[model samples]
Target: MNTLSIVIPALNEASNLPAVMGTVPVAELAAAGWRTEVVVVDNASTDDTAAVAHALGARVVHQPERGYGNAYLAGFDVATGDVIATGDADCTYPFDALPDLLRTLVDQDVEFMTTDRLHRTNRRAMKASHFVANHALSALSRTLFRNGLRDSQSGMWIFRRYIWDGLDVRSAGMAFSQEIKNAATTAGYRFMEVPIEYRTRGGEVKLNALPDGMANLRQLFNHRFRRQGGRGEAGIPAQKQRSERYEAV
Candidate 1:
């Protein structure tokens, strides 16, 4: 049976995890031939993040190295599935969209899919400054990497595990979001974007808008100018590489 690993990076989402976990359509996912496994990365939280996830029947991995990228990289290292889906633990990204997101990946024959929250249902979902910063980062990505992405800062993404073999993911901070997309697009991975509804998160917002924005901007320029010699690829032919073997961490 095909496995689908849902990776959720949580800081202190004890209250919010139930809502997110409850929305996962297990029956539908099973009917569609995916055995669901939810992996929650506890990113060094003071609250009961790990306990809540364990009580809810999720495999919790404690990541002492605290960063958005570090949490996700830890999750990605341990996810045992053909396809991996990532989202925020704060409940900003919709859990109900997983079914469509998976279907779109199969139908379109794409390796990577990310949500576009530009046409969001909740107007107050994102601050005006954040919205502007996101757009600026997206524009920078398009200019540097030439991928027509509308939302570069989106935390939600789904893709085949093997795609990591051809792409380099080196960021250990918030800039990792942009780095993954840039590497994927630069390596010519098939990409698609799904329009998703954005909502206000239940937990305390972790994003430092100005600092994170500046870091992402610098990452964009650096990636465009840098020449990665041999570490870019997985050091093997794409067809020769094992589909299940992932070495991102």
Candidate 2:
């Protein structure tokens, strides 16, 4: 029975902290032959985010680097589980949906799982350009290298420990999300995507739309136009071949 270490990267999220902590089913987790622990990577939050998480039984690691990727990596380095599950702390991602990711591994024996924000139930605040960007990037990723992720920018993901252990997480900022998918494809790791809703953040979005969007576009083009080796073949080892059959996440 392996443990599950949930890495929650947060930045001044004290308001949402208690709710998230209360939402997770820890007793059920322990009963299922699974030990559960959370590592909250506080990205220089001025509030009591770290203190609150500690009160709720989460180990807080302060990551002064100030980026989603860096905070996630900070939490990952200290994770104790065989599988690392990462998600946002702003309540945009449903912590209740975590079992879906765990079930994916049991049922499919796959290596990675990323959530799709375009799920059926929740309403999306997608601007026209954002929708276009999502589709365009998704299509390009499939066409160019078969990354096969419907939502490259999705914040929720569960990854096998070995796959992450073998590779270096070099992205220090938002673009790192796309960069990981780029790296994953070349590495022959099995990929899966589950649909998760994306609601507007309770507070303002931490993201800067024009700049982040442009950065995403640049990464996409780098994948589309740049030499194939970095994004597609930088550090990959041969693995098992893909099967004809598939399971929907």
lDDT of 2: 0.72
| Cα lDDT computed for each candidate against the true fold | 0.82, 0.72
Best by TM-score: 1
**In model 2, what lDDT does residue 167 have?**
51
| Model 1: worst 10 consecutive residues (lDDT sum) | 240-249
Candidate 2 structure, TM-score to reference: 0.83
Error of 1 at 4 (Å): 0.5
For all predicted structures, in order, the TM-scores are 0.91, 0.83
For model 1, residues 127-203, the per-residue Cα lDDT tens digits are 88888778888987888888888888888899998886667676778998888877887788899877888888786
Q: In angstroms, what RMSD does candidate 1 have relative to the true structure?
A: 4.0
Give the CA lDDT, 0 to 100, for residue 13 in model 2: 93
- Across 1-249, the per-residue lDDT of candidate 2 in tens digits comes to 778998888898999888777767777767666688888888889998888888889988877768877777677767779888877888777777667558776689878877787544544655556666766766766666666677777777888877874553456678777767766766688877778766556554687777887777777667556544322344532121122221101
